[model samples]
Target: MSVTAPSLPAELAARRGSTVELRGLVRDFGGGVGLTGLDLAAGPGEFIALLGPSGCGKTTALRALAGLERVDGGSILVDGRDVTGEPASRRDLGMVFQSYSLFPHLDSAQNVEFGLRMRKVPAAERRRRAAEALELVGLGGHGARYAHQLSGGQQQRVALARALVTEPRVLLLDEPLSALDAKVRVQLRDEIRRIQTELGITTFFVTHDQEEALAVADRVAVMRAGAIEQIGSPEELYHRPATAFVAEFVGLTNRVPGMVAGGVLSLLGAPVPLAAPSADGPVTAYVRPEDVLLAAEGVPATVLTTSFLGAVRRTRVRLEDGTELAVQHGTREHPAPGERVGVALAPTPVTVAPAV
Candidate 1:
């Protein structure tokens, strides 16, 4: 894609972006809390999403990097230069929060231009840049509308415009689309990804929604208990999860009891390759719903329920051992509830952790 013209004034173009790194970052919050020597980095212009459940330190880590929170240890570096002591104002980053945070009295254009105005940018240049930023967010003609005058999604676009107007080196997104409706959330999410790609600015997106993280990020950092459990591409995390937590958190995984003897997990009368080497013993095998198939000759199971999901149907089946697993297949062929059927495991690789 061709590079768009500069959205900010000429002098600010050089401040575009730099690689970001966090090393041995530590924060204390009294009782065995805060980021515990967390380490992560983002390549120049790479989009990394910090994903996890609430209180998982994803937000805290984002805040620390934004200079909103102080770290008890480690350093924050931008462009290979340490900026651990820099204030938020000096970080050259833009942040969009969950809330719209738009000025009620200010119109869309003025709101987008607010940051520029604070920096004493010439009024005419600020207007031009604000218009450009609004256009970039697909709100070109709505600059005259106020927060109350715009829809939730539109307001978010304005918030994004305001954040991008100054052309910061890094964009920090903190659940910017969580407040919108499901459809709007998806639409805005795609739009955000598009805009980020267009600008090619390094972005750190903090989100608790697994789908959102998987949909937009170049790499996903799954955090647990103030530390990164795993970091990889979405496909890598989904298809080859590194741990039980990651396998369970990123997507649905059916936990079925199995024997881990001979470096394999014996589940559903079939031996599946283990994700990693585990001592021979009983284990809980993790399998995706799509990997479980209905076969004419296999382990006996009873169909508990079937949900019609447009092109695909999700069937819940209970094995003789009372283990319930979900299976997804075409809606055209579905088993009725209470029907006795044979279930088999697909050839897809499975991950197994010690049964607790």
Candidate 2:
């Protein structure tokens, strides 16, 4: 699934990425919350992913930026110019969706040329740009194929070509790879990231898939209740989560009961550092499965189940105190159910919330 970078024409290459700012955006859908004082900023050529659960206002914020949804408050700015009240047609943005949205009758080249045609671009230049766009997506000779003539992945490439042919100031992707199978999703996501990097286009991607967001974006903005819960690089968000919500949402986290005293947490007979300042008291420590290991010398537990997950294996064990923990280790360390094992917590810093 390697994609060779395609060379762009001088005119296309000369385009610089634009800065985008969404300041205190508020979108209310009557009884439902769309957005709540949401604010985000993106530098030129930066890729920011809006990630969260369904109904978390990620899509609403994206639509507002694209002028597809009206905002009740706040302003939208691109390259320092206010465009809050501008129509979608005047936004100079490119967007791709989960659905390919290609015209049924039009071939790949015609579909890619649709945007140029809408702007009344000359037919000769439109054909040249369309051909180049298709080439850019690694479908150089597939321009004559129709929607039915292409696979899901190829159709998506054509849709992407159409979106990019306009050389937009900003690119908006709303779960564009959700419909594909697992392998295709991974392949297309990588290709999308590579193409975006080469083009240096400012992008805002909206998706509920954490892995997808973590893999492609320069920064991930995790949304909750119509606002950004946390925004940071993938490593920062995963390794040093600012809050319990982020730790539990960004990855697989085990809620283990522990006592926090003198800025240290005692979990499974191990002293672990706290990632953030917490009041000294009982708390539910958020620990990643990878941070737990099946050590020979630690708290005794009985293995309840084990599951193999490709490169790693996870085993669930119940402690003598009845506390269940998931330990992730190498596949070679397989432990059968009903077997007694010792579980130990790694010395990694952990995020904790008030004891429930």
Candidate 3:
């Protein structure tokens, strides 16, 4: 016989999610501002990440969507309905914070049932829902454990169960994996993505971790100075970034001085044809470490350093002209720091910006 999965509660399944739209949202903080007419949208069941450095307004934008922070102008909409003025309690959103906000006195099941209790759910139904939520998070047998008795990862799992048990219209994650260790963060992040996919709820996740954001989100919005600098799929953002900020922020890049003329850039004595329009003058070409190749008959250079990264090794080399660049290679035969070598471009397209 084929095994079948359990079904979600009918009432809960009926309220899966809705499209979220932020129209020129603005939040001011006197001296400068929190958000400067920021606009974003997420389709039903789509996972979107707001990624940026500290104080770039990513968290502020998430808070505004959750109705925790007031917006000074513009509107918030869900499924094409205006909810700009709705209070936090009426917004029907489930939020998970970086800190596991579980009550010390409450066990896992009790914590998961707290929201239902506040909504006046009957005791029997609340118990059933709480049990289901715990099972959903792979913590079904640990419901009797309190926060203090559970590990950090388990506590965060309980917190997630509590937020998800409500079956709210939207799911908001505010750097939920920031507090855990590297391994636990990766494991829990994968779990979160799995659960979100099973439920098909529209999700808005905020984080400063590029790897985490790129791994978990369907699309990433890079923010800067209280505004969105660029938004695109992870591959698009990494490969064809619109600006130098997006190119440098989304991944590691090496800025090399080059000159452009007749739609070709001359870098390190090589001619690279430009795919996009660039000013005919000096420019800073951004090249990824992996795009730099170590060849036997290329620009002569001396190895500076080599760092092992599992399947690949990142080797830094200094050219005859004293220019340094990093090259990633899969071979384990690494040269000494003073050993001579040759480096060349990998024939991949590069991004160029005005020289600074």
Candidate 4:
């Protein structure tokens, strides 16, 4: 599968928040600004990821959408309806935080039923809904367990059940899996996607993990400072990054500083043609690690390092100028660091971003 990058549109803000549009949403706390005129959108049932570094306003956006953080300007909308001034209790939204946010005093079933109970649903119906929500998260038999009796993943599952039980109009997640273990995180990642697909609820997930976002989200919005850097499908963001930041952040990439002339790009004095977009200018081309193949006949270099990653081996090589690049190969012929090597790509289109 290939990943496409974002392209500069004729109307930059034309499609802003067409789904879950945020118009000039700004938030500031004392002297520190949390968000600045942020505009974002998510299609119905589309899993959108607000991805960025810590304190880059991803969580702030999710919080603002959940009515936890008040926007100083602009408005918030769900399915094109304004919910900017609506209180959290009045907004038809469900949220899962970085912390599980479960009531330690309540049992698993009780935690999931908390919202239903608050809404004054019939006891029989609330019990039925709580059980169904728990089953949705694969926590079926642990209904009576207290928070202390469940595993971290189980508690988070309970939290997921709680957020989902209300069947809210929109779903917001603030690094909900950040607190889980690696294995559990991967397990729940699939679970969250499955549950979201089953319910078809509009979701905005906040996370600093690129792999998680890329693996879980239909589209990812890479954020910088308080603004969105680029927004596109996982494939688009990975293979066709519009900026150097997205290229470097989305996947394992080897960024070689070079210049493009004509339709061919020259790297370390070698002639190379890109895959898709045609650019004839001075630019830097991006090559993914897996894209770098150890061809039978290519430029010779020395391997700096090699790491085994399950089926593929990631090898780092240094050019004649001591410049280094990484490639993942399938052959088990391990090369020691500093050993002579040769590398080239499979002649696929490459993404280029202007040098900084």
Candidate 5:
């Protein structure tokens, strides 16, 4: 989707992108751990997403970078300057939380001007900047509308405008789209990516939704146990996961029993190449649903169920030995439950974990 917003002012347009680095970050919540020696770095104008399941420290890392959370150990550096001891207001960062957090009494323009007002900017300049920011977020004529008067999506646009009005060195988004419905969430996320690209600002987005991270990030960092398990481009993470955890987390994966010998996995009745070296033994292969196809001649199976997903259809089939596998195919080919069919495994390289 294409998103068109008004051009930023000359001063805001000339804002140079900043580099950010998190070195050995550690945050302990007494008995609970938030971060454990986490390390990450972002280049100027880079968009990185921190993604993982609950309790993975993605939020903690973003909060620590924004100076909203104190670190037990480690340092935060922006543009070669250490800011570990700086306060949230002094960190020169902009953050948008999951909650709108807009003042009910303030209109859109005033809400967008809150940061500038706190910075002691003159009234005239603040007004001009606030108006420009509202225009930039596609709320140009709605500046007079209060939070209650605007829709949930519009309120979020206002919140986003508020965050960008100050022109901070880095932008931090903590589940900013979580509160919106599916359609609005998709639209707003695309708009956010477009705005971030136009501004050329460093951004860190925290989200537990894998699809969201994959759709709009230059690189995705998958966290586990308060530390990053893997960091790579969306395509790399999906096609060539470095670990079993990442293989299962980033996309839909089917665990098929297999035997490995000479770096090749014997899955079903087909021999598939291994993505990485594994000891020769019984193992569970991580396979993508698309890799399993319905064929006219292969291992015998019975269709258990099928789900129609937007452009493609995913069908679950049970093998003669009782192992269930999900196969993805075009919607034109629909197989009913209890229908006997032949299934085949494509010779794709797969990641595998030791058998339980």
Candidate 6:
């Protein structure tokens, strides 16, 4: 949000298919490192989301890749060309931020053409490109409306149109949906995905909302501290996280201390089979809330709280040994807070991490 507008270059950039490659890229801005040696390669026309909690270097990585932040180490290559030393103006990238900083004086068409004009694109060519961009965003008739005259969603679409009008090789989106409401956010998120796929331009998106990232991106890169913890498709990251940080960060997890010996793991002093058999000793069993299936043939747990959550009910149950687990069920079998119930895992993705 603190990004200042850079001086625009005066030349039209022909859009090209570009493969963005970041290898061991590091950036430090006085207060420790912003990004450690990180490596991620995004194919041409691929939509990748940089997902992580706050201060995890997602934004920092984005800025570096966009040429807004200087890289202190490693190289950044676009379309197989090493462009790490390129300035922000030199990088053929169109970026959208959480805040839509639309010009108050310029209408939708002019706003979309602003970048083209700054690049010294011919006035006639700019208009054609602007109209095309507005059409791409489903705002064809609103081209004459000023920013203040449009709705919030329309204004945001104008911003998208402006970014797309530039015809940049690569597009970068940084938490653009965070500024919108829940309903509007979902609507706009889907619209953005549609536009991206239509354009088939390589893109990098940054967001902390796992659901949003998983729903829209071709691949999700989960970051921790100043490093990338894991990067994979939505299904891969959700079903098979490479580390405990990713499992806990990407989704809701019920972590319980356990010890594994041979193929059977002991949880709360009861033997339970894990999805994978691992070496013996102390470990943490990570069971998702949805995985905690309540059945008559499972371990008994005392329900501490039951919350009716529409199609599903969330019940926090306390084991006899003082361990608490959350069980998510689809049926309306509402158990009282202090009632005892049975719990087990479902047939979906089940994983357990080593105990720290």
| Residue ranges of candidate 6 with Cα displaced over 4 Å | 1-16, 268-277, 347-349
Query: Which residue pairs of candidate 4 clash?
Result: 3-239, 4-235, 4-236, 4-240, 5-240, 5-241, 17-21, 275-349, 275-350, 301-341
Please, what are the lDDT tens digits per residue for candidate 5 over residues 1-356? 23566776677777778999999999999878699999999999999999999999999999999999999999999999999999998889999999999999999999999999999999999999899888888888889999999989899999999999999999999999999999989999988998898889999999999999999999999999899999999998998898999999999999899999887789996789898899999999999999999999989999999999989999999998889999999999999999999999888889999999
For all predicted structures, in order, the TM-scores are 0.95, 0.98, 0.95, 0.90, 0.97, 0.91
191-294, model 2: which lDDT tens digit per residue? 89988988899999999999999999999999998899999999999999988889999989999999989887888767898898888899999999999988
The local distance difference test score of model 5 is: 0.93
Model 5: runs farther than 4 Å from truth?
1-4
Q: Which residue runs of candidate 1 sit more than 4 Å off their true CA positions? A: 1-17
Poorest 10 consecutive residues of model 5 by lDDT?
1-10
Better of 4 and 6 by TM-score: 6
Residue 346 lDDT, candidate 1, scale 0-100 = 86
TM accuracy, model 2: 0.98
Clashing pairs in 1: none
Report, for all candidates in order, the number of backbone clashes: 0, 0, 0, 10, 0, 1
- The candidate that wins on TM-score is 2
Clashing pairs in 5: none
- Model 4 bad stretches (over 4 Å): 1-19, 30-33, 268-270, 274-282
Whole-model Cα lDDT of every candidate shown, in order:
0.89, 0.92, 0.88, 0.81, 0.93, 0.83
lDDT of 4: 0.81
- Report the Cα lDDT for candidate 2: 0.92
Candidate 2 displacement at residue 147 in angstroms: 0.3
- Looking at model 6, the pairs that clash are 283-355
Score residue 46 of candidate 3 by CA lDDT. 93
lDDT of 6 by residue, 1-356 (tens): 11122222223222335798899988887886588898999987899999998989999999998898888899999988888998988888999988899999989999999999999999999998888778777777778999889878788889988988888889999999898888888888888887777667899999999999999999999998788898999988887777778889888888888887776777655666676667888888777888777887777888888888888888899877788888888756888877778876665544677777
Residue 333 error for model 6, in Å?
A: 2.3
Q: For candidate 4, what is the TM-score?
A: 0.90
Error of 3 at 312 (Å): 0.9
